[model samples]
Target: MSFQQNLQSKLQGHLSQIDGRFANVKLLDQFETNTKLPRSYAVIGFVGFYLLLTFLNIGGIGQLLSNIAGFVIPGYLSLKALNTATKDDDEDLLIYWVVFAVLNIVEFWSKTILYWVPFYWLIKTGFLLYLSLPQFGGAKFIYYSFLKPVTDKHLFHESKPASKVN
Candidate 1:
């Protein structure tokens, strides 16, 4: 097993990781047990509420919730990552932030038009969750496949001295 999976298994042996990125959903799982709730129902119902909000596009609240999901979890994780002595955790999350920065830059300019896109908040929230989740490696895949090539060619080149005209 990889270091992260191993570490997580050891640390969160009893908790479920469904509600959000940072916290465990064991409490919800435990509550469901006595109530005899279907596992899938609980999962779907929990997520569906947020998706319903996005689907309805209730003013800006749906978008706000989606954005909160994107930021609050990672912001907390970044702090936890900062306090840890292990270099591995820092390196893992660093890639996520890099991808987020690139996406945010693009979003900044494109957001005015993005509202016209169908289910924009739902799509954005799903993408952000996929990027932030370590098990998925969405961030790493995009970084290596797309961003790395461009940055390696342009950003890295800028750090080198220019050729002399003489």
Candidate 2:
């Protein structure tokens, strides 16, 4: 298949998945019922909302919304993960929370300076999303690549061999 056809096929599959998710949502059901458009169009509405909050002359409101969203979406996901019978999902959530804690610590110290950079909140919110989203596998990658190594070295050292000669 040509690249364009491949891309279009992948996008169609993704849209169908998103539509299915929205169709299951009780709140969005009301909106979907009234429209001929598929429920996935709600994603476009959210994207517009996000862009308005992000780029408009809204002062600190954008930053506030970004922070709230960055927290709330993953917070809800973490709650869902906790309530599930399988504990397997907890590992990613735990790593995500750990990284969030480390992020906040650094942000607490550096925020004043960070805001001077363009779109600091937007960047931070995107980073948090990247860290939390399972599809990205970012939290797992970071934990194993960086955080786990340090902890294992300092906190979980191998037992020393018997010191005395046999």
Candidate 3:
């Protein structure tokens, strides 16, 4: 198994022995769901971090540009989510897009110590929860976009039927 899967397996084993094993499982499941969901905070975090890096300008236009970029990546990711024929894909993508768009709007216009500090704390805390969760659903989006396509192609190649000899 891959390093991450091995680590997750070991961690799950250890966690299952803890006092509140079931609770931990439920929580991890929730987290995994969230991570897999399209346009979720993981994607937002990546895009937001990128925008912050790219923009050094302390102006309205810079803020607008960043917000636009943030919207595009997550939105695109959400769109790509439709490729998954799984049952939960639609709901997950919906949740992600809605939350992501709303939060991105707030983050975009936030300025000064008053808005920035508390909002930063709030978003940061949410992000921390996201990161701390054992299984984040948002991870699925990454896996699907980057890994699943290749894996699927390998697993299910296009085939042709053979003619019957009558």
Please give each candidate's TM-score. Answer: 0.69, 0.77, 0.32
Tens digit of per-residue lDDT, candidate 3, span 120-157: 44344344334222256653454456545765788566
lDDT tens per residue, model 2, 1-166: 9999999999989989988766668767777778866777877788778867765528677678667766887798889998999877887888888877877887888877565878776676677678878889787888899988988999787556743434
How do these models rank on TM-score, best leading?
Answer: 2, 1, 3
Cα error of candidate 1 at position 95, Å: 1.5
lDDT (0 to 1) per candidate: 0.77, 0.78, 0.51
* Ten-residue stretch with the least lDDT total in model 2: 157-166
Question: Which prediction has the highest lDDT against the true structure?
Answer: 2
lDDT of 2: 0.78
Question: Which parts of model 2 have CA positions greater than 4 angstroms off?
Answer: 1-12, 153-166
Output the lDDT of residue 10, model 3.
88
**Candidate 2 or 3, higher lDDT?**
2
Per-residue error (Å), model 3, residue 17: 33
Better of 1 and 2 by TM-score: 2
Please give the range of 10 consecutive residues that has the lowest summed lDDT in model 1.
14-23
